[model samples]
Target: MTCQRRIVSCLLVGISLGLLFTPALGREVSDIKPANPNLCPKGREILKYFQSIYGKRMLSGYNVYVHTPDDYEQTGMLAAIWGRDVQWLPPVDEVIAHVKAHGYLLTLHWHWFFGGDSAWKSKRKTPVNVARVVTPGTPEHATAMKEMAAAADILEKLQEAGIVVLWRPLHEIDGGWFWWTDLDRPENTAELWRMMFRFFTEERKLNNLIWVYSAGVGDLKKKPVELRKRFYPGAEYVDISGIDLYGVNPAEDEEPYWTFFRAMAEVSPGKMLALGECDELPNPQKLAAGRLPIWLYGLPWWGTPSARRPVEQAIATMRHPFVVTLDELPAFGDEDPPPVVGILSPMDDGSAWFPEGSVTVEGYAVDRRGKVVRLEFWANDQLVGQLANPPRQFRWQWTDAPSGCYDLRAVAIDDAGQRFRSNRIHVNVGVVDAARGRPVTASGGENPSAAVDGNYYTSWRAPTEAEEAWIMIDLGQVHSIHQVNLIWGWKIHAEHFAIETAKEAPSQAASWHRVYEGKNLPWEVWKATHRARFAPTEARYVRIHFFRRAARQTWGGYDLAAVEIPIPPSKGAE
Candidate 1:
C-alpha cells in the first residue's frame, strides 16, 4: 500500500481498537477542554504537555527535596514532575527554589495528620468511615476544610507566579490501610474526592491546580479491577488517572503496572495516566520489553533507592530514549507558539507488526507562526527518515526491522530552522502474530475476539466451566508454524491445556491432532507467558484445548500469538 493509504489504515485500526485508547484520542486530546473548565492557563499548558506525550513518552519524576533521584546524576536526571507532601506545606520560597526556578511541574500530596490519626502508623492504618470528613457540620469536616484552605492558599501563590500545581488529595482511598478511607465502600471514597473538587474549584476558585485522582497498590493485589470504577470520582472531577505503584519488583512483578494501566483505562477512558508515587522505576530494557508505557509522568516516593530501583536502574530508566527528563521537557514559560507535532501511527496502545513485512509510519504536524518545512522520524533518537511537508499528511515507510522493541519519535523542523517534537512512542515489530485481528471462537466465553486484539488489557475469557473450555483462531490460509505464546491472566490461569492445529475445520474431535499439552504446569506460569513450541507444522487453524481449569480460579483473561519459525529449544519446549 502507498504511504498515504497506509496512514489511513493505521488510524482506522487504532480507532477500531478502542475510542478510549490514547492513540484514538489523537490531537483532539490536546484541544479538548480541561476537566476543570476553570483551569488556569499554566495548568492547562502542563496538562496539554502531558497529553501530547501520553503513550509515547514517560516523564521521570522524584519527590522534591527527597534527594533520591540525584543518584542518577551520572547518566540521567529526572525532574519533569516535582512532588512533595503537604505536612506543614513547603515554604513558598523553597517551592520556588526547587520547582519554579528549575521550570519543573509541581505536584502536592497531602498526608493529613487527622488529629494524629496517622495512616502510616503500622497498627492504626485500618480503614475509617471518614464520614465526618466528607459530611458537613462536623468537627472532622471543619478540620479537613481548614487543611484544604491552607493548601489552596499555597496553590494560589504558585498561580500568581504562572506556576502550576497537580493537586492529588485523598490518594489511595481504597487501600484500607489509609486513615481517611471507606475502603471496600468506594462510594464513600468518591464522595470525598468530589468534595475536595468542589472546595478547590468552586469555592476557592483555585484554577492553577490540576486534580489528580490516584489509586493505591493495596487493591491491585487483592480486589477485582471492577473496583477501579467504583473508586473513580468520575472524569469531570479528574484531570489525570493515577496509580501509586510501590512494593513490587519492576523486573519480576510487572503485572501490577499493566493491571493498573488497563484498570484506569476502563475506569476513566481518555484521561492522562500517571504514576503518582512509586518505589522503583523500570529500566530501559524492561521498557523495551513492551510491558509498560504511557505513564505521562511519575514520582518516586520519598525513600532511598534499593534493590527494586538501583542507581543503575534509575539511570537507565531516566536515560531511556523516550523518557522526558529534566532537560528535555518543553519550556512551560514560553509564550510564543511553536509548531505542534504528533505521531499518528503505530498506535502506542498496542499495535504490533511482524518483521516479515514492511510497516508504514506517519505523523501530524503544524506551525502556528511559521511554515513547517519538514518532518523527521527518528528511532532510538537516530534520524531514520524525513518527509518534506507532504501535500497532505506526514507519511514514512518503515521496513526491515528485527524482532525487538523500538523507541520511535518525530520532529518537525520549520522554515526558520526551529524544531518541534512529538512525544516518543514505542512500537513492536515482533515475530509474526498469526492470530492478530483474525477470526476467533471459543467454546463459551465473553469477548472471544479480545484474545487476538493485540492488546493484553482485553482478553478472551473462557467459560466459567468446571471442565472442557477451549479457544481457537483461524489463520484463513495454511502456513508453517512452530511456536505459540499464551499471555495468561492473573489469578485465573490455565493449569492443564493442549495445543492443536488443523488445515481445515475438523468435523470431529478425534480428527484434531494434539501438538502440545501442558499438564501440571509449574506454578511459575501464573503471571508470565506460557510458550509451547513444536516441529514445523502446516495448518490454517490453531486451537488451545483446556481439559481442566485451576481449582482455585476460573478460566479468565487470555491472549494468544503464534509465530512461524524454526525450532528453538531454549525459549520453550518442542
Candidate 2:
C-alpha cells in the first residue's frame, strides 16, 4: 500500500478510550533484584524466579494453555511457562485456576488484530504511520488507544486477580509480517512502543506487568543490537529483552544463538534475556556444554516440531536437568490440579472433509497430580466417543457425520470426579467429491473452495477490479502425491500468479514454499482442464497468490510444459 493509504487506516472513530481509565501515578523503578518493582507480588516473584535461573538453568515452555500439562505430546512435559495470544484469550477464571494449580508463568503477545485495522483483515498490509499513530489528538492516536483500551478491559481482570503478565506487545517489530513493523521508519516503531508503555503502565495503571521487548532475528548481516537499537523503548520501559528464532538446527547454527545472547545482553544491559519464541528447542546439554550464557527462559512455539525426529529431540531436551518443568516450580499454594484436556484435531475455525462421512477425533489429557479416569469427545454437547482411562494421546473415530458446522470438544474426568473441559473448536465438514475434498480459504473470493470442490458446476471468481487477490485450499492432512487439477473450463488468468504449498496450513509467511510461478497464461487455452505439475511434493495446503488478476473472470488456466515455462525443483519462498 502507498504511504497515504497506510496513514488512512490509522484513523479511529471513538475518543472516549483514555477517559475510561484513571490516570496513573508512576511507581519507582527498582534498582533491586526484581526488574519491575511495581509488578504485582506474583509478577515480582515470577521475575525473581527467572532471575534466579538466568544463565544457570532454563524453563520448559510451550505455546499451549497448560489447562493440565498434558497437551499433544505422547509424554507430557507439563511445562512451566505458557505463550499465549491476546486476540483469543481464554477465560480469566480458567487462567487463574490453571496458574493456581500449576504455578506457571504466562507471557502474552498480540498480532495487532488483523494487522491493526479490521478492514485489512483479508488483504494484509505491513506498513504503518506509527509516528503519527503515537501523536496526541491525531486520528492515528485514536486508532491505537482504542485498541489498547479494549485490550486493557481484558487485562484489568488479570490485575484484579493479582495475576502478573509478562507483556510482550508488538513482538518481533523487526519482522514485516506484523502491522507495527516499518523498517524504513524504525524510529516510528520506537514511538509506538513508548506510546503503549505510557498508555498501559502509566495511564491504565497496569502495574501487574513486566514489559518484555521482543525483537525478530533480523538479517544475518546485522547484529541483534543493531537491528533493535532504534526500536528499543528504553531500559526503564523494558524488563526483559529477547529475539525469536526458527528453522535453525541448534547443532548446526549454535553460533547464532550465542550471538543473539550477547547482543540481547548489550541491547538491554543487566536485564534478563529470553528466547522470546522458537521453533526448535536448543538442547539443554548442548547449551551447558557450550559454556555460553543461557537465556533466562525459552518458549518453543506451539505445534510439534515438523516431523518425528525433531519431536524426539524436543522430548529429550525437556528431560535434561538444565530445563525446568511445571513439577519443579515453587508452589504458590497447592490448589488441586485439574485434569487438563486439549482437542488436538480440527483446530478452532479449522474445516475438514471426511470422504467416508466420518470425523476422526484426536486429543490429549492428563491429571497432573492425580489420575484421569475417563475421556469423552463431544459435538455440540452430544457424546460422540468415550474412553475409560484414556492414553496420553487419545484417539477415536466418529462415523456417519453429516456435512455441517459443529462445536467440538473433549472432556476429562479425574478420579476425584472433577470434570475439566477442553477448549471448543468450531469446524465445518463439507461433502467430499470424486477428486477428493478441499477445505478452503481465500483472500477475497466468493466460494473459493468451489475451485477445488471438484464440482465443475461451480467455480471461483476474482473480485472485480481487485489490485491483488489469492485463493488457498487446505487439504486437512498432508498428501504425498503432487499435482492440483483445475477441472473443466479454462481462460486467461492473472499475468503474475504463483502456486505455493506448505506441509501445514500456511498461517505465517515462513510456512509457504513456492513450487511454480505462472508469469502469464496463453489466451486461447479455454474450455479445457489445466494442471501445473511440479516435482512430487508433500503438502497439506496449496495457495495461488495472485499479484494481478485478469481483466475478465478466469475459470481455470495453466501449462508449464505446454507453455514452455520451466518448473524449478522446489523454490524457496520469502
Candidate 3:
C-alpha cells in the first residue's frame, strides 16, 4: 500500500481502538458530571481567586477564538492569542472543527451586527433603541424578539454540536454607537438583558451556553452601575464577566485600567475572565510615527514587539484562572485542503503625491490535485477587475487609485479557470508632500546603511558616546512625543547604546531628556535592559549615544533596525 494510505489506515485503527477500549484506553465518554460548584453563580468570589493565580501562571485547557479559516492556518502553538471573527451568520460546524483540531475551549462571539457596524443592521444606519424591546405591544419590540430568536437558534446549534458557547453579545453596551446600549436610562439596559436571557435559556434551552458579559475599558461611572444592576438579569444567566480596556498609558497618574476589571470581577466572580477584544492602543507620537493614512484608533496590521508592552501589562495578571494557550493543541491541519496564496496591490507607500501608472499582482494557486492556476483580480471578491496579463511585476499608476488605503489582492486560475485568492497586500496611496524630503544618510560606519522596501526606504545606523548620530524629524505639525525607542540591532552588548531627545532648535532652551541608559552586560537581542517613562514633550531632535560595545563582543560595531515612537495619549483615550 502507498505510504499515504498506510498512514490513513493507522489513524483509523488507532481511533477505533481508543473508542472501543474507552476507560481501559484512558478515555471517558458517555457520562455527564455536574460542573464545579464554584462555577459562575454560586462561587463568584472564589472563581476570582482562581483566576488571579491562573493568570499569573500558564493555563492548561482554554481555547482562543479563531474567526477565520486563515486564523488557524497562519498561527503556531505558542502564539497564546486566539480570535474568532464576529460574523453575523452561525458558524457551528466551523467552531466544532476548530475545537477538535486545536483542543482549546471555544467562545462563540455573539456579534450584534454585520462587520461590527450598527449601520448595516436590518435598518441601515438607523439608530435602534434597546428600551423599545421592553414595550411588549410595539412592533419594534416584536422585531427585537425575532432577532433574539435568531441568536437563540445559533445557541441551539452550538449546543447540539456539544460545544460550550461563550455567549458575549452586545459588547461595549456603554458605547452609544451600538444598538444594545442605553445611555439615557440605566434602567432600560436591564430590559434588553432579560430579553436575551429569556430567548437563549427559555426558548432555545441551551444549558451549555456560558454567558460572558463584556464592557468597555472607559470610566464605569459613565456606564453607571445603576444601569447594570437590572442588567445582570440574574446569576443563572452569566458564566464569566470581563471588561475590554484599550487604554494606552502606563503612567501611574492615570486611572489604572485594571481597576475597571477588578470592579467587574467583584460584581461577578464565578465566571471566566477574558480580554474580549484588545489591541495595542497607540499614543500620539507612535500614531504619527506609523504615518497611518487614516485617523483610525488601532493598527490594522500585525502588532510589533516594540508596541506590545501595554497590551501585555493590561492583561498582566488574571484574577480567576480559567486559562487557555494555543501550544497545547496539535497542528490545526495535516491533510486538509492545500492553502491558496494571493498578493494585494497598490504597493506604493503613502507619501506618493501621484499614483504609479499601473500595478499588477501575481498569485500561484496549488490545490489537492497539485495543479497550478493563473487567476484574475476580483474586486470586492466579485467582479473580475482584470484578466491578469502576466505573472511578473504588476504595476498600477498612482492617479488611478482612490487616494487612500486600498486593499490590493490577486488570485490564481487553474487550467479549468478556477480561481483562488493569493495573499493580500495593503496599499497606501496618497499625495506626496513637497516640503517633506527624505533624510540624507549622514556619515555612518560600514555596518549600517539605508535600504528600500517597495515604495518606502528606511535607514539604520549607529552612534557612539563619542560619536552621536543626529537625525532630523519634521512632524509636519506641532505635536508632543512622550515615548521613543531607539532600535539596537541584535547584539548581546546592545546596552552600549543610549538615547537622548532634544528640541530641533538649540536656540529654544535645551529641552532634552536622556530617555535610556544602557546596561553594560551581555544580553540577547530580544531582552530589553534600558527603559524609562517620560513626560510628554514637543521636540524634533533625537540623538543616539553609544558608550561601549559588549565585552568580548564580535563585530565590534553598532547595529540598529528601526526607530519606533509612540504617540502621546489622546485626552480621553488614555
Q: Identify the candidate with maximal lDDT.
A: 1
Looking at candidate 3, the ten consecutive residues that score lowest on lDDT are: 292-301
lDDT of 3 by residue, 1-574 (tens): 2223323543554454345432111011112121323223312332333343332222322123211112211111122333343454436677666554333444555556622245323454666666676788877788777766766766666566555555667665555555666767745765677677766666666676556677655656765554554455445555555555564353221234335545555544444445455443222222122211101111111222224332222222111111222322222213222223333222222222233323444322333333434445543344336543343223333235443233355554544444555533433333222113323243355323231111122324444432334333333344455544443433423546655666555335466667666556565442122333367665555445555556534444454433334342231111
For model 3 the TM-score comes to: 0.41
For model 1, what is the C-alpha lDDT against the true structure?
0.64
Give the 10-residue window scoring lowest on summed lDDT in candidate 2: 559-568
Taking all chains together, each candidate's TM-score versus the true structure is 0.52, 0.53, 0.41
What lDDT does the true structure give each of the candidates? 0.64, 0.61, 0.42
lDDT of 2 by residue, 1-574 (tens): 1212212322210122123222111111234343344666666666666665565567777776322223333223456778887876788788777665554677888777633553222355544566677789988788788988988877888788766778888888777666677667788888888888777877888888888888887664653456668777777778887888776675456767777776666666767777778865677656655433467677877444334224456656654555666645664323355677666564331134343456777656777667889998777688877899987667777775564445667888989888877756543343322223446666764666566543333456656556567777665666553454343223435556777888864888999999877665543332232355678777767787767544444433321111111112132111
lDDT of 1 by residue, 232-309 (tens): 888888888778888767666766677777776676776777888887565434444455655777787742333456
User: What shift in Å separates residue 5 of candidate 3 from its native position after superposition?
Assistant: 40
Worst 10 residues of 1 by lDDT: 565-574
- Write the number of the candidate with greater lDDT, choosing between 1 and 3: 1
**Winner by lDDT between candidate 2 and candidate 1:** 1
Off by over 4 Å in 3: 1-81, 85-91, 114-124, 221-230, 249-255, 269-272, 280-324, 328-574
Best by TM-score: 2
